[model samples]
Target: MKALFDTIKIYPKLIITFLIVLTPLFTLSLVMNKYGSASVKSEITNSMLSKVHFYNSTLENEFGRTIAIMREFARYDDLDLLSNRTEIMNYYEQRGAIRNLQKELSVIKNSSTYIQEASVHIPSIDRTISDDNFGTIQQDEFDALNVLTNHFESPFIYWQDRLFISLPYPIKSNRQPPDFVVDIEISIPLLKNALLQFTNHTAGNTMLVHFEDGWRIGGDEPEGFLQAINSVIQADNADNAELHSATVDGQKYLIAFEKSKTLGTTLIMYERESTVLGPLDRYTVWFWMISILTLIVIMIVSYSVYRLIHRPLRTLVRAFRKVEHGNLSVAFDYRGRDEFQYLYTQFNAMVQRLQQMIQEVYEQKFRVQHAELKQLQSQINPHFLYNSLFILYRLAKKSRDENQIRFSKYLSDYFQFITRNSSDTVTLAEEVQHAKNYVEIQKMRFASQIEVAFGELPASYVDLTVPRLIIQPLLENAYKYGLEEKETGAKLTVQFAEDQADLLIRVEDNGELADEELIANLRRKLDVQDAGLETTGILNVHRRLQLQFGAEYGLVIAQGESGGFSVTIRLPRTTSM
Candidate 1:
């Protein structure tokens, strides 16, 4: 079993892996395409049904309230007085009751959002009293209203392009027109507005249908389209609210409806079938296309992998083994025009680079040793040591015990730090403390000639590992070169600052001789490639920082804002070397 496993190559293994990863995805896509459509259809159906039921209930409640008001107003004793012309003709005597009755009609009309007008008709007197008018109605108008009451069993009647709810509903006998009829006209525009709410949300059409009477209130569709929807609804024969599918004028539609038993009407909402299921159908096509595309890609990738990766990898491996055995002359000779061609060219260049880098490494070692020797020689400056010992001797002869003790201590700490060459790097705190010791020694030597302000190192950067002796050189240079000529008011400032990217230790001095020409010379020296080998001053610090951290971070020198010179030593903000 182990031998057989070892015999299998990368090409077959990769093909097997591709099949393993993609088979389940293809199966999952097929499963989702099959079941997902049904789930989406069910959700759409429930949503449309809920909307249809909501609008249907809204219409029923509004019409039901108007009918209730009409029925209640029909029993008022004032309506009976308007039944005969004698009671109505007694103008002065009945005027008070007549005005009261008109007020009541107005109240009823104003009570419902759907009520356009409310009126009482007296057939015997041929008079009508409405919310707005009290006068005789046309005989044709009375006849039209009278005929509606006789024909429809429901109080909700559609007559002569108008919708109304008449009192004394569910007319069973169709006897003589009731002595007085209370008619509440429903505002078609208001009903359309109510229906528009549903249609606007669903991008559908709405209809309030009186199926038996063949009348509808809210659809601008062709008669055949409306008839087609009605046929589908009747064919469904569902008493409860339902969603149905129908074909009208060769265009498919999805219809949802609920019947209002109180108003004796069906509220139907229908939308284009494509509009409802377009997303699902489009997703199905994309899913199948992607599944097939992925399968083809697997096959094509397997072939490409064998032709591209497997062949180049083998050739590169052979070249690597020859180089691993110390044969530096091995080179790849690939001719194909592809990424492998580039890789082969790079491999050949890399072998040549290896030979050249060997010689450069040896030269670099020699240079580093030479620079270190120069660094050691500059650190033990005979002039600086002579001056320091002479100052101690002078302080002792002056019989200044306090000055001797303090100066000796500062000198001891300064020599101890510089002479101790145990490591190439030290903590920033230790380096700053060493720099302070040198500054203190100089202060005592200058004796009130210089005002030195040493800034406190921030706690965040105190523990950072930096190249040794980087900061102290800047302060030494400031004192020796820049401040030596100043007679009085020789101000020296040392500050520690940091930003988002680097930590800066700035040393500035108010010296008379420091000028732009000196700063430009220092900057030009810093830019020299071999500056690290020549001097043990700012350029040495710059090169050491560049070698340790990066070329971007080092020393920057410029004119100080205090009419003097400033030398800033920049180090990366890091916790370790």
Candidate 2:
């Protein structure tokens, strides 16, 4: 898996990542659309139910108000006084009573638009007073009124052919049967119109179901829709006030119901499911369209990025691989005016600089090897010259020629000592022997004018190796620069001592020129790091000692006792000779 991902290009990687993120977002949008659709349908049904409840409440209030008005009319004092038979016996009193009753009924009828008629029947005179003259009552009308009187405090209601909602108030004298009945007839058409004004149903039906009498107030409903509501009303436990769902006429609906216990009526509001959730379906379609467009846009952008960025970066990666393999000559010459172009230009310049550095390093190594070969050849030439001189010195010694013998021996020994350059380093004893040979030669040249002495070194320090020709130069300098200038013969002494962890070899000479100024001059020259061999001959020996051992093992020049110049050669005490 890891290898497959590593081989995939940058463009594919970005597209894969975008698709992975987009998948979950698309799923969440679909889930939200479904949830929002259900929520919208529920809210619409609840809102319609709220309006139905308002209408029911208004109906209840109107019914209560009408019943109260009827009770108020029953409290008339004239009706209470008419219980006496004497008031109906006198012709003048009877005539005054009938006129007063007519005027009161007229006033009651005029008080409300819902009241169509008002009338009072008296059994004693077998006569009825009314707010309007509607001819005469038939036998069937009288029988219906007689049966309705039996149900006390009930409204006289019927909806077959004609509509009526009347309240019958019976007047009882001295706890006997009612002396007469007062009826207030409410206009059914006007009441139905008033109830319909509160309805807001778009599809489906709204009804005020009077369950007690099996009559509904709202007009014009489909038979199936009406049956569905009536079935729920007839069901014993259908008093639940919450909105519910039902199917009627092969169509889905959301139903909301509220039952009024006081009026024995139920308020039912319902609308078709498809109609209520119609907008949600439209919204879902729109959301899917937008989502598809978004995916298309992402695809277009991914392709553009692959061309502009990923392709150039891949080329840079290839260049890096070449550099890793030591090929600094590789170059990237991307030509467009973008960030990658600038980076490629700089990278190509860097490769050129790296190539130059590589060439310079190779040339430096060649020069170093040449110098080492020349140094070896130079050592060989000196060894051949010194061997010939050694042979000539033995021939002179055999002849017993003192001057020639002395000169030949010293020259031969000096040449042999300096020319034996098999290596740059030798033991301290060998270095000291070379120094004594050079001093003897110098003594022969100066006669008894310079006296010289050699001191014995410790047995333990004799085998330490040091740079050859280091001590002989100091001894030669003491004779040519110091002892030769003095009138009295100067004493030259070579002494060895140990100071701390080093072997100190001191060469001191007492001469006229070995004063404070000469000692200071010699010390100053030894202190200089870059002094050349021709300018500072003694300083060259000091620098070689330092390079061979370390900075601590070097020559230090100073003043000795009673006008003598002392040069101390410091070397590390090492057992590896």
Which candidate achieves the best TM-score against the true structure?
1
Worst 10 residues of 1 by lDDT: 146-155
Candidate 1, residues 204-259, lDDT tens digits: the string is 78888888877887778989888788778778777679988888888888889988
Model 1: CA > 4 A from native: 1-20, 33-37, 81-93, 147-153, 168-177, 201-203, 289-303, 311-378, 382-409, 421-425, 445-453, 487-491, 508-532, 546-553, 557-566, 575-577
TM-score for all models, in order of appearance: 0.78, 0.47
lDDT of each: 0.80, 0.68
Worst 10 residues of 2 by lDDT: 145-154
Model 1 CA lDDT for position 545: 78
Which tens-of-lDDT digit does each residue in 427-478 have in candidate 2? Answer: 8888787777677666656668888899988887788877667787788678
